[model samples]
Target: MDRPWGVPSPIRPGFAQAETAVPLMNIANILTMLRIALVPLFVVALFVGDGHETGWRICAAALFGLAAITDRFDGQLARKYGLVTDFGKLADPIADKALIGSAVIGLSVLGDLAWWITLVICGREIGVTLLRLAVVRRGVIPAGRGGKLKTLVQSLAIAVLLLPLSGGFAAAGMVSMYVAVALTVLTGLDYVGQAARVWFAGGPGRARGA
Candidate 1:
């Protein structure tokens, strides 16, 4: 099919599945699964001691950083060498949500992050995840730049907050989280709009019209 409105079709990544669907145990998918596996380790370290205790917090941050780094590596490897599989497509985002969602919820439990911030961010994450699944057969709703930026901001916020910092650094982390929240909401709306066009307006066929 032709490109979608001069942008590559959101489902373009799915094409990787067609070409490299089998041999699913490639490096990229392994990295993604490793990321998923690290979530519990992160949680254990996070809650092993009182919330702001230095040692546990550092362990948690290191585990979180490792997991986050795996996320990038998996995606890069997937794209860099035709390694995307259906499992990777499904597991990658689930891994991300498991990691970040657990962190946010753990922070709320530890009284670091506000319950409402947790609610808003987690709610959007869940809802958009469901939205992606709902529309998957229609077309891919690939992550836009804004969505990636939001993830980066959220990850930075979580990392900083996990570091047991104080004063201005803590303040900056809070600000980063709020910015992430705003971008999350905005991108959620953007996804809805993009989905409407892709699935409802005969997305693939209309590429020529544009």
Candidate 2:
């Protein structure tokens, strides 16, 4: 049975069987793959013409925005349509990290953003991703509200920073980025705590209700 979004489910044999009933190539998974595919294209746009050409920057921001939109829809589609499969569980976050990672790294490379900010945000994302993998056998820790808020803020900040803006607009972007970074660190710590609980609980059977 489909549970609420972000709630962990026990990794039982029956859970695997239920997941098998959902095809791998559902709409949600397709959107997720599309988001992943857009990353390289977004990078290309970002780097075109010395990586700061006005038109190219606009194109890159547009591509990033599109990918972010897909990220929003896919999860909702999966839950509403009962299309949540194991592949979706794994690939969705990977797609998110790919898009966000590429954007921030590309921005840093172009000197549009600070390397320290990039390092902190990317570091937290990478660490959380590894934590998830380290405890995959326990259960999937779905993105909580804090995590979702962080992504939303990160995307907004990146979108602003991608534009060739200055003055107050530029300051606004930095402020937003700072908030996103704060959320990133806070949520990362929360996920780590959750993973530790799930880990010491022995398995998903016990972690599910947690």
Residue pair clashes in candidate 2: none
Across 1-210, the per-residue lDDT of candidate 1 in tens digits comes to 442111222345558544433466777778888988999999999998576789999999999999988887777666655565656776888888888899999999999999999998888788877866766677655666787788888899999999989999999999999998898789878877887786785443111000
Tens digits of per-residue lDDT for model 2, 67-170: 99999888887776667777788788889889999999999999888999999988987888798788888777766788889999999999999998999999
In terms of lDDT, the best-performing candidate is: 2
- lDDT per prediction? 0.77, 0.84
Q: List the residue pairs that clash in candidate 1.
A: none
- The TM-score between candidate 2 and the true structure equals 0.87
Q: Lowest summed lDDT over 10 consecutive residues: which window, candidate 2?
A: 201-210
